[model samples]
Target: MAIYSAERRRLMEMLHPGRHQVFSEVLSSLGAFMEKEILPLSPKLDAGEASIAKPRKALFEQGMTAIPFPVQYGGLGLPFSVYAMAVEMLGNADASVALSVEIHNAVAEGLLRYGSDGQRKKHLAAVISGKTLASFGLTEPASGSDSSTMATTAEKKGGEYVINGSKMFITNAGEASLYMVFAKTAKGPSCFLVEAPNPGLKFGKDLKKLGMRGSKTSEVIFDGCRVPEGSLVGQEGEGGEYAKEILHGARIVVAALNVGISQIAYDKSIAYAKSRKAFGKPISEFQLIREKIADMKTGIDAGRLMYLYAARIKEMGGDYTSEASQAKVYATEMSLKACDEAIQIHGGYGYTTDDLHRHWRDARLLTIGEGTSEVLRMLISRKELSRAQ
Candidate 1:
């Protein structure tokens, strides 16, 4: 079934009545593009038969990268919900591509929320327009969730900040032209905009991964990488705050993407169960198989609702940190379960087939990438406890 014409339309109508038509039109247009340009390349992407850059550039040209930014900066200026649903569609098209684009957009989001006016005019437009791909450099080998313990440092040299540190598991690392890097300054943690081709900017070899192979993942090393004073975003010592804000928003999109993966996996399972036979009848006719299908469908629906609820709360300008964390924790775990069920229903064929198994592999990374399921659970409970007082 077409994702846009089905549950997407239903949810859009329930959440946005007056604007649903316009949203649907824009999404459908993007969906059509995905169906033609992206879906066909999934197998090739997974197998290393094709380059991700080609499809990503095609998407950029079609304006997929500028969905939620302000029109003044070359974006469509649409609501966050619309951009999120578009991400879900992209996830269904190709998980790797979706991941690469998601990280790229997170950098744009950082600049939008924290950059100076001159910085926005100079850098944000290029990023949103896809002239320059961006990466978020917040993760380090020694520090994953604890930002305060980061060892990366940025020292003020006469007219520049000399950065020295390493960022691990950075998505779109080698392919990006701009990086929103976080490091320590005298005041505290700070954010900086570091351009590529600097004397001290270097990349480690792309790390091989179990999934999302279509995207580049590598270590970014900043050995005395120097940038002008104007490269500071907002102010020195605000990087921690900016990183937290950027991540809270990103968690919602990650949830939506996982839901998309679940939807596709569930659909494939249903189709296979109907056709594959056992005991002289379709396995789908069996009670156990039917139960798996029902559970998968229910979980996908639940995940979709959770992320959409968080997105709606955010668009309304409310505090959604708890909601976003809840959505991410639930949806990422739910996608894993759903994909596992899909593989179980597919049996031996699923284990051997890259197409069927790739979904599960792709879903595995989400639970650990943005925030580990364990960490998010703790964060959610902490918020609830504080609110109770």
Candidate 2:
């Protein structure tokens, strides 16, 4: 089955109506590529039979990471919505690969937003062009959702800054060529671009995960790790805001990713409901089964529109934190619900089949990864309340 659906095309048309020709061409090409190359790898990625690097690298070569970046940085210079939709397709193709690629692109997004000229010239093009792999290193073992309370520290020592403490649950940990790490300085929290192969940097073994098994997640240890003074992306003490901004954009992409998972699960449920017979008739004819299909489709549409709206706001240079949070919270939960309903519709086969149930496993991580649903709800509420005042 095609990963990109008619509904997805219609949604794109809704965004620009008759002017979505460029978007259509790019999306159709990407969808076709994913259907052939990435979709077949989903089960193997979950089962650990294949490594995440090769397919991810192939996608990067497809300019997936470069979509929303500036053309000077070897990007396609497309809008953020294009990138978000691409991510949705990727999620349907293979959630593990999508997770890894999105984390890698997050680093690129940070550099584009906050890095200096030399930093951008040196690392930005390489990162977006797939010459180097980057990983986000903001969360720590001591600090989960509360990023401001992170324990990692960076002390200036002449021309270099010495970094200590560790980052936990870091995606692409061992494999990343560059690490976009956050640490506390005497002034305040700061962002630094730390290169790999440093003597002081070490990574813990890849953590066995509940899902997104293809991507490596581990503890990144910084024992007096040092980077040149130029490694600082933006001014010191401002990293907190930078981190927040980066995450806001990432939340939209995360929402898109979950929507992709829901689409696949919904598609599978539909096909199954038609093919699987009960009481000498297809389950699709049953009122209860039809209700499940309707609910799944509705949730998928709502989740897709939420992310797209958030992405559009972001592209317009508006404050999208509230919208981003709302999209993330809703889409992640929506994905979980859609996957669960799929399993229910599939009866015993969904419970037993690895391929069918893996959608739930993959969707489970997004609720806790970028931002917890509970925290996002609070953020949305706080923003709304502040606006009301």
Candidate 3:
């Protein structure tokens, strides 16, 4: 059975007629561009390490550089829905690259929303054009789910604020030109825009992980790193609020990425099942294989719908924290299952690295990164309880 019914497609199409058209064009363009310009470059770089560096320039030039931001800053300023669909397509092709771009967009959106005119002029253009990259520095070594426990401190000095703390598992940490770092100031936990190459800012060696190898993940060490007093982003004591809002929106993006991955895994598995034979016929002819394919397709479709719903809520400027968490948790878990089923359908070949094991490895990270499945469950439970009260 086809998971996406005509009614569902029509509803999705109706969400934003003009924007969807543009999104479709951009997705098609991105797919072609990745095949020719980006994926071909993947071989030259560490399939894992190259995620941060390899596609940064091309993605900016060909993808993000033209969307989301204002025309004044060399961007198309397209609707968020369009930008999100493009992200989903990119994610389907290469998640590491998609994630890197997503992080950049997240930071850029923060700057656009909270940055002063001077700050925007100084930084936004380069970021929009891809001349420079940025990362969000919120997760501390000790603070993963509980950001309130973050201990990174920023002390005031003469005409400057000195930051001393470390951010762990930061994407695009070493390679970024700017970092939006959160720290404890006298006022409270505040955000600071720290420029790169500062004497006091250091990056630990890249941490090896099980998946998402293409995206660079590292720890940032801040030892009395100083930036001007004007470097503060948004109002003092309001960093937490900003962080929450950013994260709420980010959850939707993460869900979209996972949905994309799930769809790709389903497609690959379906193709593989049709070709791989067992007994006297193709394995796909078996009832068990048919059941697996049906389940995988159903999961991917459900995940995609959840993501689109979340995206729509965001577009409507609704309070989407619960919906976003639901989407993230559901889609990521679905992708993990779908990926596993894909491997199971492949049987022995799936266990081997040469087969679709890489997709499985990549899917593993979806459940953990951004926000772990556990954290998301807690978030959803809290929201539900609050509403009941």
Candidate 3 lDDT, tens digit per residue, 1-389? 12222433454478777556555556566667766665554433335434456566877888564576788877886766656666666666677777888888888888888899998999988887888888899998899888889899989899999999899999888999899989988888898899999999999998997766778889999998989999999888889888887888788888878776777678778888899888989989999999999998888778777777877777777878898899889988888888889889888888874326666677778777777889889989999899899
- Report the Cα lDDT for candidate 3: 0.78
Measured against the true structure, the TM-scores of the candidates, in listed sequence, are 0.99, 0.98, 0.92
lDDT of each: 0.91, 0.92, 0.78
Better of 1 and 2 by lDDT: 2
Candidates arranged by lDDT, highest first: 2, 1, 3
lDDT score at residue 3, model 1, on the 0-100 scale? 58
Instruction: State in Å the error of residue 289, model 1.
Output: 0.7
Model 1 root mean square deviation, Cα atoms: 0.9
Tell me the spans in candidate 2 whose CA falls farther than 4 Å from its real position: none
Per-residue CA lDDT of model 2 for 66-108, tens digit only, reads: 8899998899888899899999999999998999889989999
Identify the candidate with maximal lDDT.
2
